[model samples]
Target: MNLYPFRCSLALMAMVGAVISCSKQTTDPMEMTSLPGDTVLNVNYESGTLSSGVTGISSTHASAVDANYMVQPGAKGSYAIAHKVVYGDTAYYSDGAYRSESDAVALPAARFAPGDERRYEFSVLLKDWTPWLSGAIHETNIFQLKVSGNSTTGSGVPLQVRVARNALRLRYADNIRVYNFLADVRPYINQWIHFRIDAKWTLDATGYIRTYMKLPGHSFTIVDEKTNYATFAGNPAVGNIGYIKWGIYGIQEGLTRIAYHDDIRIIRLN
Candidate 1:
């Protein structure tokens, strides 16, 4: 009856088996899915780094730039990008964080053109924003469809999604003039908002710009819809190459703002 030796042998085998199981465990990184066919650009900032498609452009002032723009954890395992702009920033064009499909000299085929339909969608949560000034316009461009042009002459930016007086507004460039397309977004302030823009760029009478908004626990609502909207008339010299920019661009001094963006995507529908 040598049961002690038998028990010792059994215990040794169990320890060896546990060690083998532990050695087989892996710590490989998970693979991310590629953007869909229609999607020209998609960024959730889950990679903890800015994609090559995104670029941070700012003026000379160091305090107004978004030098720390990076991925941050969001709700339910999701992620988002954070952008901050400080007050009393003298930089004319501060924090021009943007994303484009390509940097080619010529306009990419994926970009929207005449008769081409496209959509831009994103989720924005305003963490902090300065109080709106009465009678005076304190605007900040949070999103824009910008065209390349001469900065000295000051001619560019065909479409702009601006936040002013705690309201979302759409500005489009005309012949030496900028007109407001929509100005009824004051209700969506201080909350997470889903914004969607549908545009058909045309030089003739068929062009149109449509915007949609969705608050939490509700479906998308059409905020603005316009037909025969001419966005490129003012800046004829503006290049065909266009891109999308999103971040806090302070128009006036002594105002600080912070926002979080998630699920930004651009799709070619035509």
Candidate 2:
């Protein structure tokens, strides 16, 4: 809402010798890898890598109605942009297509497009209830949202108010658990539990240059598990790859339930 996020949280606990520095503006080649036990990040995962836009670049998902996963009015619709799923009964689309529900499951705000060095990979599968606003649901096999928007959400930008590169999180609250907001890092229902996330942001001129992320399963260790490197600090004027985003996010009364996201892969992180 104010967008001043330069909270390097301490650069992941810096001063160890100070190798942690980010404001994003680069020449590319600041590689730092580690996160492979079993992969699922697509776009062409030989092992992992991509980067090439400005061309016919295209990718999208998230859209449903009479089946479940509502919210498709006008800011526009398409399930938030493209990429959605949540089934214990229904709300899917990895190719299964089972859209048709209405007991009450509203979530808007999460359109997709992560340009720049683009290598976005997200994973889902949650069931956090226990104090997660209530507690004892446990379907969290893994969860992730490794980002790297670098910049641009339209308007003067600055909605979630914090983008020293990209980490704009607007939550419905719960640093961890207790109604588990901010999408609960990637939570809502908790059953189909199986998520994936791989990120890559590399722009420059002061916005980003290197934002690599890898989402491994069973990694739902809990507590935002280091909110994406938990080391903000990267804002080279900000600007990476963007186009569509809304993911309205939900939660507020009735605690929580109904969350599923499947096989979403945006690539360019070669």
Candidate 3:
């Protein structure tokens, strides 16, 4: 007479009411508000693993070397967006494979873990892209943030790269860029497209970071070119969320592309 611990205590009370309704959602954390993007902790491409922030891009400043591109979750709310091919790493197609239209490259796995609260949330389904000749289809969504000093290249650290891509913009080049507020939806290529990015720290006084991007179907553009970015934290180095990576970017080295990501959720916005 045990009902499997009463269905595991009602699935842990529906995952604690979906994380207290996603921390009491105030709306527009990046949109999609029904949660359950597949559970396990949610991260796309089939839960390779991602919690809330920190993926690719890094710099302790010694000629900067940072990397985080993670996606490993499939089956539950739809993930296996394909690209594990025969299993894992296989780089060498800056634009060579997919001869008929070959494009499938992914990245995201940054977590330096020190100060915490680096924010996360990215989604895809622009139909897995493929139009790179110039009309522009190098298709992107990689919030590559790396600021090893850009207050005029003093050498490094003093980081602050925040991107929302729907309402704000900032950039300070040790490395800082957020993208895609619909520069090319390609007629909703594969349909499911949603993106949510959240970051904390606000007073709007001295140091700045107010980047935003959101394309509610033709009507959102914050620029820098690759897409959207707003980064600049003049001088308080040594904090970490440390490089948040997303996927796909064969930008200027020859291009054919792929796109089809699902409900990627990483949260923490203030």
Candidate 4:
């Protein structure tokens, strides 16, 4: 009996299967689920790479995940993640938009739901942020809680943090301004700015959103707050999953914008 040849063929087939499986895991862009009882995600970039809490990276440029998105030393600590976007960078575009951004996709547990109260805390350092040319109104979103999965159900961008026209503004949906956190951002350039957003996702009047910010030699203070209002989307049957994105995303303003993020923590407090 010649069983050696059969065993060799089986080994080759197993090796090929393993290779394909490993490739798929690394190449997949979507992570659909999270570990049970997991309610916290902390990324400090001290490990020199994205943590498992981050499912994947989304960007309009192919090289963005490799080149523009980097782990470096800066931002409130010895290590942080840098997000860089250049003007007219259109290497890869399939994110349903015409923009250059390097966004880290959060886990499914990070999503918001009714009765879900979450606290988002992160530190940002704007490296080269300047007012738009001639004070033009161009959107430069630094953080967003956008609808994922089924985009047709809920609001496109439920919440976002934008730096435009030399100020930082908090917005809901398309253009609803929740608050103007910073009236002037030029003074904070190249300086660390810490933010804490506490949101209680609800459809009725019980929902509330409280935002706090801090700078060097300062303590956290409430920048703005919305209480007794609907924090989540209006649709009760919304099928979309809410996820978090922290990075630079928006229209190009003929200038390279760079920002550093560190100590990003999301705690589900429901």
Q: After superposition, how far is residue 48 of candidate 2 from its true place, in Å?
A: 30
In terms of TM-score, how similar is model 3 to the real structure?
Answer: 0.23
lDDT against the true structure, each candidate: 0.59, 0.27, 0.35, 0.68
Better of 1 and 2 by TM-score: 1
Instruction: Kindly list the per-residue Cα lDDT of model 2 for residues 80-169, writing each as its tens digit.
Output: 121233443333332243221110011112222223333333323332433343433322212223233432422222112111111223
In the range 213-266, model 4's lDDT, one tens digit per residue, is: 887778777888778877776454756556677767765546777777788777
Could you estimate the TM-score for every candidate? 0.67, 0.23, 0.23, 0.75
Error of 1 at 137 (Å): 1.5
Query: Which is better, 1 or 4, measured by TM-score?
Result: 4
244 Cα displacement, candidate 4 (Å): 0.7
* Counted clashes in each candidate structure: 0, 64, 42, 0
lDDT of model 4, residue 252: 57
lDDT of 3 by residue, 1-270 (tens): 879999999999999999988777645433324434322124444434332232431211111111122333432363434221111223422223211111111123333222333344455443344444344333232334443334453333223222122212233444454333334445555454443433332213322333444444643222332212223233334432234433343233333334434444444331
Candidate number with the higher TM-score (2 or 4): 4
Q: What tens digits encode model 1's per-residue C-alpha lDDT throughout 62-150?
A: 34346336545642135666666665444323335221111212325434545667777777767655557576787777777766654
Give the Cα-based TM-score of candidate 4 against the true structure.
Answer: 0.75
